[model samples]
Target chain A: MMHQKMTAITALEHSVEIKAVSKTFGSFHAVNNVSLPIRTGEFVTLLGPSGCGKTTLLNMVAGFIDPSAGAIHIGGVDVTDVPVHLRDTGMVFQSYALFPHMNVFDNVAFGLRQRKFSKSEVTHKVMQTIEMMKLSGMEGRRISQLSGGQQQRVALARAIAIQPKVLLLDEPLSALDKSLRAQMQVELIEMHRNTGLTTIFVTHDQGEALSLSDRIVVMNRGQIQQVAEPIDLYRNPANGFVASFIGEINALPAAIYQASDREISLAIGNIRMTAPRRAEWQFGQGEMVQAFVRPEHIRIATSADAGCNVVTGEVLTHIYQGSHTITRLRVDGLGPIEMRLPGGDVVGRVPVGMPTQIAFDLSQVILLADKSS
Target chain B: MTRQRPFFVQFLVPAVLVAVIFAAAMFNVLKYSFLEFVPGSLNVGGFTLENFTRINRPIYYWVLLDTFILSFATAFFALLLSYPISFALVRAERNWVRSVLVVLAITPLFTGEIVRTYSWMLVLGSDGVVNTALKSLGIIDRSVPIMYTRVGVVIALVQFAMPVMIILLATAISQINRDCEKAAANLGATPNTVFWWVTIPLTLPGILSGFVVVFAWTMSAFSTPQLIGGGKVLMISNVVYLQGFSSFNLPFAAVLSLVALVAALGSLALMKLLTARLEQNMATS
Candidate 1:
């Protein structure tokens, strides 16, 4: 029985393919030649800052806006001109966009009514969905009467009640408090697991995107810079934008010296290191390149460690986070390189203006592109 | 009413004074309605239903019905005209177009209804501009007589009624949360369905009052029917005027005015009932 159900689910096969899509508002381009393939039942997040056209791309997929060039296909069928109502794609807007004129039950039942379902079937399904959303007896309550969390649940129930082929979320948890947002994120993940719906979420919050998405599509200036799984995206960013966008990075400009089959060289502040390159970093020898190492990857020590990428500097400031210490070190030519260490575990008990030595793994660092205008 | 320091009255005192004046004014009308009319004098001492019975004739009844029919038709036509204007004013993307429409809506309201009616007379009369244009266009062989007909009165009433409906409907449509329309569309409702189901239902309260106001105004209208009908269309207001001033039947005129008041009040009550039920469900939803 489980095998049959798995096969049936596999037969559902509705992969979304976006082909060279671009959207322009008059003379200004909002999305530029972006292509992506979202596999069935895979949750993909289009992550970027405001005005990055992540929302525009999601809107095009929802059929709210037509792409200026190229096409969008759902399950291999082009639905470029299809209106929003015919697309059968569920969207959870940042504002929730729940019907203020409808109760929870009526809000959930709206799509069913549009399909002209029998009254009993609509009532039964609405009841079940409302319960599944943990809003049972509150079905008769007005939207304004419910709390923000309950209202969000009602909005989720409304969107998922129809069981559309794809679920689209546009910063749906933005209105919630931090604690509630974290809780709702867990609920959303559980919901995705239960339904196995292909979901595309657009968010400016990197943490939200990284935590929720199986794969993250990082965008900058309406162009996709990187698309990979959460771990791969965080560990191996493709460019300077992705490196700086994902997490805090201590980057310094360095000239490549020894470019070879398995290794490359970068010079930073009278210090040179032979960094291993799994593949060619696309730069010849004697070329300027930027190396980025995250704060957590750098180890601060009082004693010099040989055979490691070591840099000696003075501690500018030591910020005590709850369980960690972020020590800001001032090195020659490099203004500041931060080293985040476990609380009270950093050697020599970091003090402001005290001399310190920091060492990091060259293998863990990445070369980034220069984005100066 | 004084607003000066130390010359100000308390809110409750002024409110009581206003209520007392209202009661006295209504009592005076009631007393005048009860006064029986004799040959040379009104018998103020007598109590009788003779005036009410006098207005029960088929001629008066038909004229009263005509007034009611005219009121309903004018209100309906005004509502129909106002809906699209209100929708545009509330939904149009361009501010200039909305502002222009608003100015157009306000221009009609600022003009007195009599002036508007006179303007219509110039347009709709036999030798008026509209008839001349129609004749020139070969749509009609001769001047079309319209100034003294029900159509003329209806046209005048509609002209007067539309601005009120537009203002009220625009205010009502503004109060509707736009999210409801988006929600309707998201739920697979077509644009037309969203408009009819969500937009219209939400704005019904606003348009409902617009209808009642226009209906009451049209029912009590004296100048429009008098000027446009040219003493031909005998609406109830005309009948009341004839009884009170021309025919010297004060009692019958009072009875007719009372009937007019009752009709207006009844229609308002019906409007209230219809909208109240709809709003109750809407509130819960």
Candidate 2:
């Protein structure tokens, strides 16, 4: 059965293809010339801040907004000129736009009915979808009677009941509270696994993008910055934007002291450190570069860690989270630097206004050319 | 204890005064309805049930039925014509287009009823604009009798009621969550289906209220039917005028006025019941 399904999916060229798509409103370019191809049954996320064109690209794919240029294909068929209803793609709006006038069953059955399904078939599909979404007994309830999370499920069920070729989610979890949002994120992962539909999720929350997406397309200023899996994106960001955006990291200025094929030496203020040279680093010796280090990679220095890769700074503040603590320090040339330590041990050990020695794990450090200089 | 609002007495004084005057006038009308009508005199005699019993005649029943039918037709046609205008007024993409629609839809309300009715007279009269245009277009060999007809009266009343209808419907169309329509379309519903299933249902409350309001407003319409009807299409108000002023039977006229008021109230109550049920079904708070 799995092999048959796979072959059926491979019969189509791709689940969704956007080629050189652009959308402009007056003189403002909402989405610039962009192209992306989503494989069958893969979950991709378009992650960006507001006005980054992620939503615009999703709208174009849904056929809600026509692109100013280029073509769009769903299931290997060019649907650029097709109307929204004929495109056969499902979209879950950010507002969870379940029909207020319809009961839960009707809302879920809407697409099936529109597709001219038999009454028994529509009922069977709707009930199955509602069960999958865990909304069994609430089928007769009005939309206003449901809580925010339940309404969200109904919206999802309504979109997926038709079993469209591709599913579009426009920040589906943004309206929920933090705990509920996290819970829904897990549910979303399970839903994706169960359905295995080609899905494109849009969100501005980087943590959500990192956790839920199989591959994330990070966007900035109406352009794609990078496309990679979450782990690779966090570990090896293509530029300063991705490095700063994906997670908390300190960007410190450094000068390349010496360069070789295997290792490179860098100077930060009066301190010196050496890092294993990456193939992507083509900078020469004596050139300016920016070094990025994650907070978890920095730790308080012990007596055994004496000479290289250690810097002294005054402790400014400690933010004690339940599992870990984040400590802020002020170095001489690096400005403010944050370090995350496990447990509350660092909070009691390091007092404010006292000098502390901290070491950087140079193996995980990220180096990029200092473009501002 | 609740805090006392300042100037409470001052705020209550004008409302109290108006209510007192209105109550006194209605009481006089009620008293006059039971009194005997003296021909060729403004004075009335002692109390009698004759004025109320006189309404049992078939001619009076026909007049009441005519009034109800004309008001219903006016409200129906007004709702039909105003919905598109209201939708356009609320949904026009350009600022200038909305502004133009608002001005055109509402400006007719500022003109005097007499003035507007006269304007319609010129349009509907024999050898007037309609006849002249139809003649020039060779659609008809002779002029149609639009003037002094029920059709002419309803046409004038519909135009008169459209401004209010447009305002109510426009408010309803604007309050809809646009995402609902988009969601319907996204879920494989055609544009036409989306409109019928989603947009129309969402605006049902507004449609009901607009229809009822126009119905009640047209039920007591006096000048338009009087001028345009030219004594041919005798609505309740025209009959009341004929009895009170021409025949000098104030008691029967008061009875007719009371009947018109009751009919209007009844229709409004029916509208309230329907819209309340609709609101409950949608649960749109």
Candidate 3:
């Protein structure tokens, strides 16, 4: 299965290399000195919380807005100053920005017509793309006649029909409901596999970023926090932002008491615990730090007995999400910790106000010194 | 949803009132179109189709042709002048400009049609200020005789018809989405092509309606044509008036008035039919 999926990948020729990009709206910088290379035929998502300059970077690549200072090259040719139309990139908007006046056939043919394709050529290509998108007979239908999902597919087909060097999708599926969004994600992945077109997708939804991209560039506040493969970024985030964004992570302030190749002991007030040190940075005798561990990695202990993985805590609340549970507990020194548990884990009722301890693998935790966060 | 009043009685009140008034007025015209003069009697004694058939006379044909030609000329000029002006009004973003545009577009519509036409008469009349200025510049010896000409009639009609076209075209241009223009630009079309293909087509339906409205309005207009024609240029309305009041041939006048109404209605129907076909072609293509 992995081989087939890999076979679907093309390592396509380098499509866009946005270097040292910075876009400022007046004195406020929307995208500040962001540099990321877009691999050809790879689905790269710029993921972040809102206002993180992901969309601004995508716009610079699409040439919708000029960058303050940057060099952008598509297909190895510098397109830093190219107009949107001349850049020859297709952009699919979140709103599905399909032309209301034109029917499906003519809407898809619009770009082809601009390039002066022959009448027969435009018709054949448009029909073929419509069929490829599984909208075979929708050519005669008006744009408003189609559902949201169908309109998205038509937009996709229209974008790809021109055979643009790259596709820039600005949160294309964000407007869709969850189940439909998931379905379109699969379809989009399949389309990418079939076409080998370089695509840069932007979104604030973390799950979408994780599931769709070959690599995710997690951003925070107009700057890229980390760029890594989804699995790697989830398993090992470069800093606090990626750790908290990709999944449920517990961030606790700790001081590195001692460090070695195998283990690093950290202290939070009177509580001290030792976890494996994966970071390359060396700490002296005492340095304030941030320790991150995934919520799922923590195991709940039924009783507190001064065991190896234990903490005396007062339970504040319990939330029942289907198939799982979240317990909000106030540990001795830690303010409050949320523990996620799957169904069928506990034998007795786990109600609020009862004390519980959470245990976790030492190696799964990471330490960072980005105090600004 | 049915009303309690008797069907024809409910319909007939206003219907009969209008029909009776129109019929009585045209009856006088019928008497005029057919009355034969007793050589010296100036006596409207016998009935004949002389004046109705006399429309075949060369003078009447030329006058008829000139009336249509002038109406069309005015319609074309109004369309040309209003389209861009309306575009600016629709696209203006500033609040003051928008309010000012609304006032400017509405001012002409608010004025009485004859008041506006007579205002043009003051400007166009020979030995009026226009010819007086020309006489001073030595551009012509006598006050240049342009007043009471077809040119003066056309000028008056165009000014009278302009406000309708402005409001209609503004409404049309306002209906277009700016995003469509951006989409065209993104597709590599230059700004001009976007206007020609996308913007113009969207506004065509509006232009068609406005054209038909102005066409019917000009065809039925009597005062401007009468006051400006000055007895020299005889339009259909003038002839109709002469038949009803001067000649008093009621039946012939009735036929001619009906012909005028039919002509206006026919053009309206033609406008709708052509546009519907255009819409059908747009959909299929």
Candidate 4:
């Protein structure tokens, strides 16, 4: 399997290959021994909470930080020891780090000028990038004169103006307001599509990771948990961390699992539920397993419900979101279980301290091996 | 409801008292500059502009020119030496390194001006530490005459002005967003290029203020030039002292003092104008 995977990695035209890269500060491992190969023109995101080594990994790729062990290959060249200036990676800093002394044109022209481009070529490229970033007439304006979103665009323009081999974005949209953040996300997508540059973005926001990345590398505790496409990652997380980190889900208590060719049965507390057997169900018949169910999959039980999947609980709280209401219920043995219903109608129907029955949509459940056992 | 205010007026009382006394002393100096100095007498005659006219002579012109040149050189050299120390003080990765640099940079300020000037004399004198070291190293066979020279005066003055320059520069450098430098490097600027293109321009305000402050401070320098220059390199301050004490021409001394004061104020105004233009150019909202 390892040999096949290695051959597959070598067969593709990977733009960046991180080989067993690790960085340790004193005894704390910021990035453990990890390897990832990014294909050309791929938009990859390192998604994890703060201090989980996502930014550290991105910085190592950008040549801002060096790995204590292992090699980084960019464009088929070993650039592990290369200094940041020599590393042909364009980076947009989170603060937008636009030169306050220079106007938009000069700031965008800086990288081109460093490469010894001709005066007219620098002007042409800068103008083209500014136009692409929609910063057309603001070339003469100082960075401080531009609005926050405009400054962000200028930062992007400055980084991409050089047409680098790889573009690295370090949480570049995190500083904007909610509305502006949504706007910039669309612009970022458009920019990525237009440039087709192999980009690696680092962000702790799972929503951004899900929306922006071609492949999301979910990470935790200085190691990669899983790397998959957006829908596959959200639907089939490799572990409990990725499942809970990606979206809201309820982790039922450790349960006994019994599987057959046609169906898989799980016993949680005194409640029993049966799910249609998936081809990927590789657990032993009597193994201990944990079940994760998304809030949307579980709903209020109607009178027609007569199965063991139905559980009784008292409503704890109702959080009314604009399009949906998240109702929290304290189950007898399962602690708090959250169910997402469409609209605020659930708030008037289910008051606090009222007992109700919630049925799990068994087909949509996610089962992982209970490692604690 | 009426808001209860803090005692801001009470806080200004001591400062106002000091300003009043300072203004009275300055008024007395202005009055003396307009009076006539009776030769060899302690008293002054009716108001006249003779003292101002005496300032146009080549000898006094040389004194004023020397003072300006020395002060400018001191400020320039002090800025050069202080910049590296200040950068290290602010940017050192180790806390102890920053602490050591701060202590060394500021320890000179605690010493009295007379004491510091006397110490420089010992270092710059014939057969002094520098001369003896050079002679022993065979770099020079003869003891170089640094004492009573413009070089000696400037060297002493530059050292004297560095503590203030470092403090101002450290503050400016610490306030810089380091991400700017990192971004410059990420855009293919070498470390050297980053320093010149980003770091230096970002600290221009601090540089301007430090230069002006050192310039003004060095203009009124008295004991450093008096002791180190030893009457050979006469600055306006030393000339003011000579006229007041040796020549007993209080009016002439007051006129020189006024000129020094005006020169300092004029430099500060120029600095203000330059900084305003800079702030406008690099307008950080």
Among the numbered candidates, top DockQ falls to: 4
CA lDDT of B202 in candidate 1? 78
How does each model score on lDDT? 0.83, 0.93, 0.79, 0.91
Q: What is the lDDT of candidate 1?
A: 0.83
Question: What DockQ do you compute for every candidate structure?
Answer: 0.32, 0.69, 0.22, 0.78
* Candidate 3 C-alpha error for residue B80, in Å: 3.0
Please write out the lDDT profile of model 4 over residues A1-373, one tens digit for every residue. Answer: 2244345445449989999999999999999998999997789999999999989998999898989999999988999999999998999999888889999999999999999999999999999999999999999999889899999999999999988778999999899999999999999999988887789999999999999999999888899999999999999999999999999999986565678898898888877888888899898876788899999999999878775589998999999999999999999888899999999988988899999889999797999999998
Question: What is candidate 3's lDDT per residue for B1-285, written digit by digit as tens?
Answer: 257556657777898999999888767655665666443344466777674675567765565566567767878888888888898898887878978987887799888877887787888887577888888998889776666887788778888888899999998888766656666666666778888978897678888878877887787778888888787767778877886667754444555676666666877898899988666544421
Error at A267, model 4, angstroms:
1.4
Tens-digit lDDT track of model 1 for B225-260: 989998999788898898778877677677788888
User: Of the candidates numbered 2 and 3, which has the greater lDDT value?
Assistant: 2
Best TM-score among the predictions, by candidate number: 2
Tell the DockQ for candidate 3.
0.22
> Which regions of candidate 3 deviate over 4 angstroms?
A1-13, A302-306, A312-319, A330-333, A344-348, A360-362, A370-373, B1-76, B90-115, B122-164, B203-285
| Predicted structure with the largest lDDT when compared to the true one | 2
* Residues forming the 10-long window of minimal summed lDDT in candidate 2 chain B: B1-10
Regions of candidate 4 where Cα sits further than 4 Å from its true position: A1-12, B1-3
Query: In model 1, which residue pairs have backbone atoms overlapping below 3 Å?
Result: A102-B285
Which residue pairs show collisions in model 2? none
Query: Lowest-lDDT window of 10 residues in candidate 4 chain A?
Result: A1-10
